[model samples]
Target: MARTATHSPARVDGPPAGPIEIDVRTRVFTWITDRVGVIAISRMSAEDLARARSRRLSHNVVTSRVFGPMPEDVSLTDLRIAGPDGPLTLRLYRPHGPLPAGRHPDEGLPVVVNFHGGGGSLGNLDQSDWLCAHVAARVGALVVSVDYRLAPEHPYPAARDDGYAALCWAVRHAEALGGRADRVAVMGDSAGGNLAAVVCLLAREAGPVIDAQVLLYPVVDLTFDAPSTTAFERGPMLTRADMDVFRTNYLGEGGDASDPFCSPLRAPDHRDLPPALVITAMVDPLHDDGVAYAERLRDAGVPTRHSDHARAVHGFICFPGVCRAAGEALAEICEELAARLA
Candidate 1:
């Protein structure tokens, strides 16, 4: 596949400078860094980022691979939570050791509705096992990771609807699941983050109110091409090329990328959305997306908090066992939501 590179036309504004190591094995990264300079990634337009990402997908096989197994200390159980539409299965992770009562008590435990990220194409409960376990245990919340339908096969609002359905299901059955429906919060990373953010908007519009939201490196905008997408177009983990594949797979035919459901940043209003805890990475393609969304939320009178992990990259939250930042970020998420619910 051919590669294109361009110099960044904008001023550099990001975390303190760090080492830039191009992945020659993935020539796209090497080529991008060599031709444009690493800073260009954070400055280039979205179209360029999308084009570069398309090239990376042609070479890299995006898969579900974690650094190591999730912490074994947390216990996980799978059950199908009944949704408004029907029975939607959920993987519940309880941080506390064996249930004192076969199930969590109704009052104290909080519930986190987790959505896994894979550009809306790949990712599942099994892949999110560790992250959920840590969040469940660390936050003292009952972590309910929803296995929403995937893209290409499922596409666009299919996953979004399933996510909303699962959120509704979790809220309705929080007590039965050993948590409080009143204290339910929504969360997701990457594509899942996109869905989670959309859930907040959808809930606000419908009144199924969530207490808070934890958006980890979320994809909030589909239309405005941010500079981050171009700056970090190719590198370890997520690549711009992969993002192109994800977008294509997710939108499919006759899909509108500008739809707020597809890109919450496009939404006219961020008001009425639940309080949000937005976590972003310093060197990620989607970094600015999260930042922009958080700002919009705050502007709209929504209580919003944001943290940028300067050293980490996109999806760093998923590497809980390996990346210390992941666990700490999850803890921050729990702290914010826990306080709000408490």
Candidate 2:
């Protein structure tokens, strides 16, 4: 990384006006990685891709180590719900003990149904535990983390159906989960953000009222035509080639890329969707996706808020320890959701 790092002549988003602390410890690791060259998925067999991806996902999966320990008041429970493909596992995060004087468990609190990133294949409930726990305690709301089906396996509409099912289930069982049915939101990061956005659009037609939607570096355009797609082509995290792999795998062979469910940006109508809080890292290829979608949302009379973290990189929300800006971004989500849910 150079200042406005020119990676083989590609100008990356520069660090915001502030400190830039390079990870010296990872320099040696980076040196090794640089010598190894990028992972060429096209050359790898299905088995090899699966193994390599699993290893990478396991390494990147966010934990208390990345996000710091969760607050003591938040408690986690693992459970299963009916999903489109079959039984879907989910993790519930709830704050323990004393509620406001008049509040009761039956009364419920604001709820958020969470979907994890990893191109839909590499994430799990255990990995996203810290964030869910934080939201449950920090926002004083119930959080449900959905473990949806993944790519090259369940494929498109599978994850979408699971995500929407999770949302509906969360609303229907809000009382049992100590969540307010009337005040509920769907949230996701990266590929999960794509699911959240599509889920909101699907809900627009005829579904439970979604109070809000929180999208963290969402993948909105399957066509990859956004300016950021070219600007951040060789993303420090999400590269253009890597995205091709993700898209192909997620969509499976001959899948329709233009479907609004796969690419919410292609949706003809954004009207009547819930308010959206779209957050993007300036360096992410999906940056313009959020911007374009937000503009369309506003044009369609849908309330939208877009926040660009200049100093953050793709997946920053899950790697707070890697970037201070990530913590700041996460705080904004908590604060924004609290205000909306209130």
The model with the greatest TM-score is 2
Q: Rate the local accuracy (lDDT) of all candidates.
A: 0.70, 0.74
lDDT of model number 1: 0.70
Which candidate has the top score in lDDT? Answer: 2
Residue-level lDDT for 163 in candidate 2: 89
Off by over 4 Å in 2: 1-45, 48-67, 97-106
- TM-score for each predicted model, relative to the true structure: 0.77, 0.84
**Which ranges of candidate 1 are over 4 A from the true structure?**
1-73, 81-87, 97-108
Clashes of each: 7, 0
- Residue-by-residue lDDT tens digits, candidate 2, 192-282: 8999999898887868899899988898889987767877676556678878888988898788889989999899888899888878777
Error of 1 at 184 (Å): 0.9
